[model samples]
Target: MSKNRFFACIRSSFFSRLLMGVVAAAITGTACAAGEAWPKEINLGYQKYGPLIILKSTGELEKRLKEHGVTVNWAEFQFGPPMLEALNAGSLDFAVTGETPPVAAQAAKGSPLVYVASEPASPQGEGIVVKADSELKTIADLKGKKVAVAKGSNAHFFLIQALAKAGLTLDDISVAYLAPADARAALERGDVAAWSIWDYFYAAAEIQLGVRALANGEGIVNNYAFYTSRRDFVEQYPALIDVVLDEVRKTDQWVKNNPVEASEKLAAHVSIDAKILEKALRRSNYGPEPLKPEVTAAQQKIADTLLAIKLLPYQINVQDAVWQPKGK
Candidate 1:
């Protein structure tokens, strides 16, 4: 062959190999980026009622996670406090609860909890109730009277706000720290003058026992539901966090759009009457939202209130525990 042609051929071959090398590296980089480190399984905590229950019942989240080879393990709790306790104990990777539990959890020493997302405030969903014929007509009437409430739960915050509006504090009232069943029984037996609680417990009381609410959270407190996870879990598996929140958002929309069907599904799991479940569902606000600045401020107010009342040991910045994805 001619010398010029031999050299030309070598140059062409070298350029072709370089182009292939660049394309191969780009493909490998894309694959690595796509194949993020996802856990094989995740443990989720849920209460008997709420969007989480809806999500669990429909099995939509399970089906989606299954596609990623991630199995879901669900753990149930009666209320927010215990569910959050499990999260703090490392038994749950993710969970959702009402406003107060996250505040209490964040205040606890060595808690690994972080606020990942929140649902809209459903102020009318919880309240303080008295017997239909009871003399307690106003919040002011509760002074020195025994009131049943779940300690460290959302109802606890509601009771505080209620009492404060009446110029009373926790010290002025006799607080019987009891679970929902015991509280209901206490209210029925006249052992406590009133019971402060959230629905479907509130709905059940109204339906089955003819109890009357002195005041719902309408003007007293913003009863927000929050989704939480361990700080490490959020940091390590941010993508999983997005997946879970997306499912929760979808489920919330479904519940809002079809309340009757959602209530029936929830009633089946909770063993409560579908009618009562529907009542509670109607009062609740659906849709999961991120921790916006305004939300953080509202949460900060709860923390400050708890601190002022000595319910919390020390002051905490609610924003400190908020999770932020890579770019806003």
Candidate 2:
């Protein structure tokens, strides 16, 4: 879909309701105070996913915050780990990442951040893939074979969970820590027996690389995408965080109502085929849900799982990083 069609689809009752909801949610002190020194610029880090892609393509975030004299700077990352690193280092005020990055971040010393919101579970968003002719027919078959995954990424946890379910552990496999690009190459070259990754790269590999998925996050991992901010940033600019999530909610509905065009726009953003993008987006759940008790529990489960596997240096209380909105 062209850019014109993408915007044209926004003119509908769904978007109308979404905008109304955003306005209602933000009307209550969600804007910067008149004399308050609102940061001159807000840096947002994102991957090539649905909500961020749509928000960037439409330039809606900049438009929304323009009235408050806030400039929106967009930085794209290959995956969540480095994005979260940027968030912790003060280069980014806000970012979205898969469930595992926060655990990894909190585990690392000197990286203080908070989970403000999250996207619903997207179990189908990621999986383990092997070449069509590979003999790795099951997770158990991965024993003694090379598997590629991005270190400290959501896929890393997925791989660990898959191995544990198969009565195997990381020691059972020859693990290769590679980014998505390198892992895709390794799989194509038969250097790795399997590759663990998430969409849209996962979908692209299946469509273009002829890989077959052996197992997905279904019943294996919750696969929630988390929205995070540096602890100090959130403390200082609670209203900006609320405004950003408000826009996130609006973009979430926009994409759900127009998945096809949304796919097209994301494809253009990431330089992937729209068909592959569509396959991934159609299965994804979008929105910025509050970090409620259930969500915190789910995150805590992930943290404990990581600690059990010795991936984390020490035990962590996931609630330590949860942001408590005023009066909540």
Candidate 3:
């Protein structure tokens, strides 16, 4: 109970409390940093052709994301349905697809996808084609004949609308659900009277195989390409999504301004002839923008049509899955 002993005991207690406070502050700071850290890698899904292909080829997105200590991985899909399937499965952080796939994805149970952005409609970018010598001269001629189309693709919706215009339904035709490559082969082999497809495949078929278009999307479909992501990804990484969309906007402008040059660059990555790509590119529109009510309404019409034809298992509200960015 001496004075020195009392003083020493008091100092010891003060130092111990101070040390504890410092440790707590350090732990809190570390936790906050960890919570805000960007992902080490992000997977982007793309189809064979589009602004994404040009973006991937230029390495611009990779370069920008690299500055944030992130890596980019690209997955290529044959068409939109399978791409959106991968997106919903958590494999892709972001993806671009024709409007039909998103409608289909939104209809799937427990789907976590959200429509983030959309490209302007390019009605001429897709079509139904037949061999130049085929006797099927019109969309009505497809009745009772085998028609190849990728299930759940924009081309599928296009075919449906085209058929309705001809006073026919899907029951009137024998549908052979096939990927673009297989469908092309089927058409060439006369196994299918017509093939529903999108460019650059549509363009390739015409130039490479001399197929003639029975009809295009001009007055039938919008053929809008959409940028979509997992709902969680959009909520968690709004800034990153902004970066991605900004780059997409820039690339879209470039493609629109230089169709031939863009086609050549994309051709290098896809190994398709530049001429075919240019033909497709010239007919297509670009520029990614936020979804408008009209666009959502158009999507709803597509959804309703699919439900009527039993293409979708159930009805879905397209607007429910549309992403609302923070503050809007």
Q: Comparing 1 and 2 by TM-score, which wins? A: 1
Worst 10 residues of 2 by lDDT: 28-37
lDDT of 2 by residue, 111-177 (tens): 7789999899999999899999987789999999999999989999999999999999999999999
213: Cα error in model 1, Å:
0.5
Per-model TM against the reference = 0.89, 0.88, 0.91
lDDT-better candidate, 2 vs 3:
3
lDDT of 3: 0.92
Off by over 4 Å in 2: 1-37
Clashes of 2: 0
Please give, for residues 1-328, the per-residue lDDT of candidate 1 as tens digits.
9999999999999999999999989987664454355788899999888899889888998898888889999998988899898999999999988899999999889999999988888999998999999988999999999999999999999999999999999999999999999999999999999999998899999999999999999988989899999987877778888899999999889889999999898889878899998999999998888888888898898899999989899999999899876666
**In model 2, which residue pairs have backbone atoms overlapping below 3 Å?**
none
RMSD of each: 5.8, 15.0, 3.5
